[model samples]
Each structure stands twice: as structure tokens, then as C-alpha cells.
Target: MKNKELVENYYKDVFINGNVDKIPVYIAENYIQHNPQVEDGQAGFIKFFKNFIKTEPKIEIINVSCEGNMVYVFYKCSLPDGTINKVCDIYRVESNKIVEHWDVIESHVEKIKSVNHNSLF
Candidate 1:
């Protein structure tokens, strides 16, 4: 698979399914996750995400784009309490594996309350 496809599938299988087995396959050994809550490497990334997914199972990816070594994705996560958050993630690929990642997250309180707010993610 191409780097973009690998990343998209990795998010689906791992984040949505709460699977950690795929991390070793899709993430580089020296992977660096830039999120403040996560440490360096895939292990830290997996641990952080495992906690996230367990608490927020209704995560969905809305869109993804790839350019050169970078992939950008937008997503929405519904917390167990019904609050929703919108998030954007950027991944840098090297040798067909994700080597670096960064993300931004914001709570979509108003959007979540509006029944007409169709999820973009």
C-alpha cells in the first residue's frame, strides 16, 4: 500500500477498532508523536490512543489528504457522555511508514448540539 493508504487504514483498524497490533507494522521504530500527552515512539503513541479509544469509542475520520510525505486527516470523536470533539491530525511518512505525527483538537459543543450538524468526519 502507498503511505497514504497505510495511514488511513492504520487509523481505521487501530483507532476505530482499538487494535494495537498494527502499530508495529505501520509505525516506524523511531516514530515521534508530537502530541503533548504522548511520549516518543509507537509504544507511547499506542498507550495514549488506547486510553483515548477506550473512553471514546465513537471516533470517526471525516477526510484525509496526502501530499509528499505528509498526510492530513480530519475527524470527530464522540465521548461517552455525548460531547463531541473535532480533531485534525498530520502524519509524516518515511520509507512507507509513519515517522512523525501531530494533532489539534477542539470541543465542538455548539455543533454537537445542533441536530442539523452532519458530521464532516
Candidate 2:
């Protein structure tokens, strides 16, 4: 599969659906995570997602793009606790598997709280 497609599938299966069992199919065994909060490798990925899935955040993919082996995804997540977050996820694919990942997350501010009154999405 193409790099963009691979990463998108990974996000849908793991993040959107909370299906950790499919990790081996899309993630490399030695997956490198640049996010300081998460650990490296597939084991770490599984551990982190297992806990994250407990809340079952609703994920909406906004955009997806690819450059070389890198794929970038922009999305929004709404947690069950009423916290909304906008996230940009970057992934590096090798041999049809996601080998690396980095992400930036920002909490969405309500329109009433923003001076510009613009949506974060």
C-alpha cells in the first residue's frame, strides 16, 4: 500500500476503532514514536493505545497528505469527558508498515473563549 493509505488505515483501525489487535499488520515491530508521552516499539504502542481506548474518543479525519515516505494527517478528537483536541500526526512508512510517528495536540477552545470566534477545525 502507499504510505498515505497505510497510515490512514492504521489510524482508522487503531485510533478510530480502537482495534489494537491489528497493530502488527500496520505498525513495524520497532516503531519509533517521537511523541515524548508515548514509548517506542510496538509493545509501547499497544500499551498506550490500550489505555487511550478506554475513553473511546471520537475521531474525525480532516485531511491526509503524503510526501516521499512521510504521511501527514490532520484530525479532530472529542473525548467522552467533553474535551476536544485538534491533532496533526506525521508518520514515516517503510516496507509497507508504519515505522515512525510524531504528533502535536492542542486542546480546542470554545468559540466563546476565542477572541477571533473561529472554529478550530
Candidate 3:
């Protein structure tokens, strides 16, 4: 599969559909996570979500695109308390499997919390 398609399917199955079993299909066994909070490899990826999905937060995909083997996905994540977060995930696909991952996450800022000139979206 293409890099973009692989990432989109990953977000759909794992985050939107709440299907954790699809990890093996879309991700590589040696998956390396750049996020300091998560460990390396696919096992770490799955284990992290096992506890995280307990709140049943929903994922809203905004955009997905690719440049060569690198895929970029931007999405909105709704937390259990109704707070919204903006997320951008980047992945590198090799031999049709997602081998590397990186993510940036930011929570939506309320008007009262807006101390800067930047928009959250």
C-alpha cells in the first residue's frame, strides 16, 4: 500500500473505529516511535493504546498526504471531557509497512487561555 493510504487506514482502524488488532497489518514489527512517551516497536504502540483507549476518545481526520515515502496526517482528537486536541502525525513507509513515526499534539485554546497571537487550528 502507499504511504498515505497506510497512515489513513491506521487512523481509521485504530483511532476512529477503535480497532487495535489492525496494528500488525498497517505497522511494521520494528516500528520506531519518536514520541518520548512511547517506547520503540509495534508492541509499545499497541500497549500504549490499550490503556489510552479506555476513555474512548474519538479521532477526526483532517488531512492526509504523502511526499515519496513520508506521509503526513493532520487530525483532531476529542478527549473524554470534550476538550479538543489538534494532532499531526508523520510516518515513513518502507516496503509498504510503516517503520517510523512522529507526532505533534496541541490542545485547543479557549479565549481566556489565549496569551499568544497564534491560532490553535
Q: For candidate 1, write residues 2-118 as lDDT tens digits.
A: 878988889888888778888888888889888888989878887777777768658777888999899998887887787777889899999889999999888765354445657
Backbone clashes in candidate 1 total 1
Model 1 quality (TM-score): 0.85
- Compare the candidates by lDDT and give the number of the best one: 2
User: Candidate 1 deviates by what RMSD?
Assistant: 2.7
Q: What's every prediction's RMSD, in angstroms? A: 2.7, 1.5, 2.3
Instruction: Put the candidates in TM-score order, highest first.
Output: 2, 3, 1
Ranking by lDDT: 2, 3, 1
lDDT of all predictions, in order shown? 0.82, 0.88, 0.84
Over 1-97, each residue of candidate 3 has an lDDT whose tens digit, in order, gives 7778878878888888878898899888999999999988999999988887997887877788899999998887887787788889999999989
Clashing pairs in 1: 62-121
Model 2 alpha-carbon drift over 4 Å, by segment: none
Q: Model 1 Cα displacement at 98 (Å)?
A: 0.6
lDDT of 2 by residue, 1-121 (tens): 8888888888888888888899999989999999998999999988998888998789999999999999999998888778888899999889999899998888753323666756777
lDDT of 3 at 85: 81
Clashing pairs in 2: none
Off by over 4 Å in 3: 108-119
